[model samples]
Target chain A: MREQGRGDRLTALLRRGPLLAVLVLYTLYTTLPFLWVGAMSLRTTAEISADHYGLPSPAHWGKFRAAWVDSNFAGYFWNSTVVVVSAVAIVTVLGAMAAHALARYRFPGNRLIYFVLFSSIIFPPQIVLLSLFQILVNYDLYNTRTGLVLVYVSLQLPLTVFILEAFFARIPQDLFEAARIDGYTDFQIFLRIVVPVGMPAIVTTVILNFVHLWNEYLFAVVLVSDEDLRTLPVGIQRFMGDYFQDIGMIATGVMIAVIPVIVVYAFFSEKLIQGMTAGAVK
Target chain B: MSAPADAARLPAAAAPRRWWPAARRGERDPGAPSWLTLMAFLAPALLLYAGLTAYPVVRTFADSLYDLENMDAPRFVGLAHFVAIWSDETFLRAIRNTLVWSFVAPFLDVATGLLLALCLYAGVPFARFLRIAWFTPVLLSYVVVSILWLWIYNYDWGALNLALRALGLDGWARAWLGESSTALAALMVTHAWKWAGFNMVVCLAALHALPSEVLEAAELDHCGWAAKLRHIIIPMMRPTLLNLYILAFIGKMKVFDLVWIMTQGGPMWSTETVSTYVYKRAFAWNTFDLGYPSAIAVVWFIIVLAAAAVLHLAFRQREKLEY
Candidate 1:
């Protein structure tokens, strides 16, 4: 019996060998850049320039302070939080309203409206970027944070409605009928029922929009020019471009931009993944 | 995905003249919103969307016909901008490069995701850890990813070259992003690397959603692993894989940030995508004329729509919904 058990264990381990190898190899491929950058962020410039692959002995931590204070990453980070939070708030509120209208109402042009709203998802937004630039300039909103915030709202609303409408579409008619019989107005029902029950999908869109707008570059780069107005992504890009020779500064700046995201992903990874892919898998 | 299903029914129901048949049947939809409530709900979003996205898109089509260069009064050069961009070197390179990147990178993304998902299902030593670790890159900004690779692709002491040299393959190590031959290819790898995990999560979800009874049936029938995968698992995952393929395909077609950050269409425009090319031309590259880039944008927009349609039909060939 002991000989038989030992033999079975050996073969089982052997059977899992190939799959294990591939799994480990791919994890390394995905994670090595992060580890490499984390290491680079800690090393001194002299050390990094001397050798690209050296462990930091002292792990000089001043670079992050320099990036945050001198490089004005703090300002950029604040801008991003404000813009993303504001835009997502509006997306949640207005998206719920519009999605409810489209999904529940069997009005003429309902499907037309839905299709038009979602078509932009597949259509490239770059086509209209030039015209948008022109519009911003014309209205004297060229470099305003308000202008950027408004643009984010519009840019994000289509997908917001798309995702929310699906959730709203499946809502039972009996619930609405019951609400109406109890003297609940449409606005009251939307506020009371649709918003609460559709919270899962709404949460999904919020995560998606936050991630997207936080990482957005094309619009931030094009729309805003003030150093103070720059978001995290645009700020980091400029830092990289201007300080290309300063390897330590570049890595630290990136870490500063990336660390919060890592923290969030660490805590809410299951929710984040489910939220991010909700449109696809759901 | 729900999106493809919605799009599939678009044609059958698009006629706007008829009121909803349910409404025309004279039955009151108690749940149906009144006109005032409906307008209040939709007007805000529609108004914002109209002033921003729809108007700008229409203006771009209109702007493409004329020379909207600088502050000068606009010159109407009908289709001349279109004619010029087609003949221009950078735009042509951008067209070809974008096309290849759109197809190749997405294919790799879906393929990699599928393999990773399969590995998880087959059971690994630390499956949970691998699942989370693999998706970390997707959270990083393209600028961060681009800069990280810049260090990695450093000609002298980058990790890749160091490893190659360690393995006695010194001759094989070269500048990955600096040279024209490898710049676009290098960018594609970064894109697929970031997005592969997304597809993995989606594919993994589908895998778990697969019914266990079928696998049990296969097990009872004494089906081998390879045969089970070939005849049952992969076939069942067809809809999911195809949906991911199309999603990734559209993503790459809109590829800008990665290429813009990594190479900035560098080394003689080797990595130029249509989006980046248009950005430089219309904003940075001396020409303030909206006409030329607008023409390129317009054409590329149509091409994207057409390519998506073709892929949808091709992948949808002889397919049935497994669910």
Candidate 2:
């Protein structure tokens, strides 16, 4: 019995050996680029050129400050924050209200509205790129943060509504009926009951939208041409163009643009994963 | 509806004469919110969606029919831009590159995702930490990911070339992004790197949701790991895999940011995609010819919609393996 048990252990180890090797290699492939970039951010330009793989001898923490202030990442960060925050707030509120109506009240055009919004998921933004720019210019809303916010809200509303609709549907109908019997108005019930109960889904959509709109590139690049009004992604692109040879400074900018998202992911990765995959799995 | 059901339950004597029409009984519930209230709730989202998304889409179709480059007075030239695109080499190349990206990137992403998910499902040590580390790239914006890879692909002191030189394989080192033959492949690598983690998380979720009973049954049958994976696990994972495929396909089909930032469809337009081509025609090019890009957009949209519909139909007919 002891000899057989030892043989079984050896076979099990042999079975798992290849799998373990693949996992380790993959983990390295996925993470090493990020680590290298982070390491490069801490080094001086000369140091990076001297040894790409070496650790920073004297860490230049001031590169971040220089990237933020000198390279105008501060302004871009502020712009991204403002646009993403306003758009997320509006999309959440509007999407919740719309989702509530669709999920609860069976009225004319209910399915049609839901289908329209849901189907919009397949419509690539490129389809509307040209006309959207034209329309923005015609309305004189071009190059403004408000315009960017409006565009982001409209673009993100469909997914927001789609995700929230599922969550709202799971809510028991008895709760709404009970609230109504207590003389609660329709809007009042929505505000009082739905909003609070649907907080988890709401938070999910908020995080998802914040990450997306904050990272949005094409619209920001096309619609807003002004240097001061550019969002983070476009700003980083423009900065790269100006400082093409400054590897350390560019790495610093990349870190500045990426760290917020990393922090958010670190804390709320499960929620992010759930929100992102919810549509696909369902 | 409840009233009719109640009437049905009552005795013959208690069954009252038909009050409301039977057909309309369940159509409207008195307790349900009023139409006006529903509209009020829906109006904001509807108006915004229409004004920004729906209307713009429709306007793009209309603009595609007219020569709108000379903005002062537009001439109606229906289908001319569409006709012209048939022979446009650059546009054709963009379409070809987009097709390559759509096919290649999604497959790599899903393949890597499935592999990682399977490893994690096997209960590897440090699985949780590896999952987080793998997902880190997905959190970074396309711009930031592009910058990181750009540094890695830098000619002078990039990590890749440096490693190659250190390994004494100096002849193999070359500019990854500056060469025409490797630009699109390099761009696809970056996309796969960033998105594989997302797909892995998705597949991991699906794998966890798989019923353990099925696996136990297979084990009792003395099925080896490979046989169990092939016969049971793969079939059970069909829906999730298909869904991920569709998502990844659409995402690759509409890819713009990575190519825009890294290559700008450069190295002699080797990496030009439908999206970048449309952008260049409408905005980047000096002429500002709106009609041509609109036509391209319309065509690309149809292609994407058709691909999605076909994939859905193909997968829809399959009998789901419920365990």
lDDT of each: 0.82, 0.83
- In candidate 1, which residue ranges exceed 4 Å CA deviation? B1-31, B320-323
Best by DockQ: 1
Among these predictions, the greatest lDDT belongs to 2
Q: What TM-score does each of the candidates earn?
A: 0.93, 0.92
Query: What tens digits encode model 2's per-residue C-alpha lDDT throughout A1-282?
Result: 999999999999998899989987888888888888888899988898778778976889998998888888999999999999999999999999998887777677777787788778778888877888989999998999999899999989988887777666656566666677888899898897777777777877887788888889999999999999999999988989997878888888888988888787788777776655556643
- Write down the C-alpha DockQ for each prediction: 0.51, 0.42
Find the 10 residues in a row with the least total lDDT in model 1 chain A.
A166-175
> What's every prediction's RMSD, in angstroms?
5.4, 7.5
Report the lDDT of model 1 for residue B51: 89
Off by over 4 Å in 2: A1-11, B1-30, B165-171, B320-323
lDDT by residue for model 2 over B17-99, one digit each (tens)?
A: 11111122222224667778988999999999999999999999998999897866778998999999999999999999999
lDDT of 1 by residue, B1-323 (tens): 24323323322211111111112222235455578888999999999999889999898898889988854598999989888876798889998999899888888999899889989988766788889988778877788887877767878888788889999999989999999999898888878888999999888978998899999999999999899989998898887888888888898898888888888898899999998999998888887778888888899889998987788777656474434
